[model samples]
Target: MKKTGLFFGTFNPIHIGHLIIANHMAEFSDLDHVWFVVTPKSPFKAKQTLLGDHHRYQMVLEATQEYPKLEPCDIEFKLPQPNYTIDTLTHLQERYGDSRQFALIMGEDNLNGFHKWKNYEAILEYYQLYVYPRISGQKIAEALKDHPKIHRVAAPVMEISSTFIRREHKAGKNIRPLLPESVWRYMDEMNFYR
Candidate 1:
């Protein structure tokens, strides 16, 4: 079975940090492909701050065009609103069956809040989690250190954040370094985050 990693995010605008981590997950881990699951609406995040789902999805596609192993997925768009990770994973498992094996790629910060998610335990039981380190994640990592399904990845922790990028752009500061050149141009031409 082919191992695919599901990297879930809002991706207000696709950035270089997102690409780097996905590439690291694909190259350094057992994943054959890393799918960037662009979420339409996250339960924990403010919907008013999000860009249109189609726009976010398109930016992800444009940013990932050069990487054969990186794919931008719109699976959640067809699902119900206020998307839940467990439901998405269940749908994917049923749809793919044994043809592919799906794993969860997440930051260590997310792991700290794992218990708050719907069917969080079920997620732990069914899918392997590939966790990349993040600032302030050491405590959570220590608590789950003995979990058999969790694999700690050594991917570089980039301090760049979408929030920071958006803030910079809104302040009329250059954010080109944080994003792919094509995505940067798209954001500029479209007047995003203004």
Candidate 2:
């Protein structure tokens, strides 16, 4: 069975940082493949700043076309909203069955606040967590530092963010280098963030 890592993000416009991180997970970690799970907007939230769900998914699809071990997943679109990680993980495992073992891909920054997530303990009990480095001031939880289920991956610390790219593009600056060529072309053609 192949180990599949689930990288969850809105990916308003999937960028090179996301691509590099996902690639690193697939190649450097125990995970054989990494799926960019494009998280949909929550219905309860009043803000609609995010791009359409399909638009973000398309960006992820275009960004990952060159990578054999990476792909885009829109499973959450059909699932009930206000979804939790545990729910998503359970659904993924059930959907794929025994053919693929699923794990969560996260950054060190998220580790500090992980205990607060819904059913955090259940998630740890059922699945492994592959955490990549991030430039953050907060420290990871003391008890989780040596947890057997959490694997720290030596991936690059990517400072780039989709928010930064959006701001720069809206300012008429060239942020093309931060994104994959296909993603950039698609965003440009759609007049996104401008």
TM-score each candidate.
0.97, 0.96
Error of 1 at 41 (Å): 0.6
- Per-residue lDDT tens digits of candidate 2, residues 51-160? 99989999999999899999999999888887677888889989896799999999999888888888999999999999999998897888899999999999999999
All candidates' lDDT scores?
0.93, 0.90
Runs with alpha carbons beyond 4 Å of true place in candidate 2: 42-47
lDDT of 1 by residue, 88-154 (tens): 9999999996899999999988887898999988999999999998887347746577799999999
- Model 2 worst lDDT window (10 residues): 41-50
Pairs that collide, model 1: none
TM-score of candidate 2 to 2 decimals: 0.96
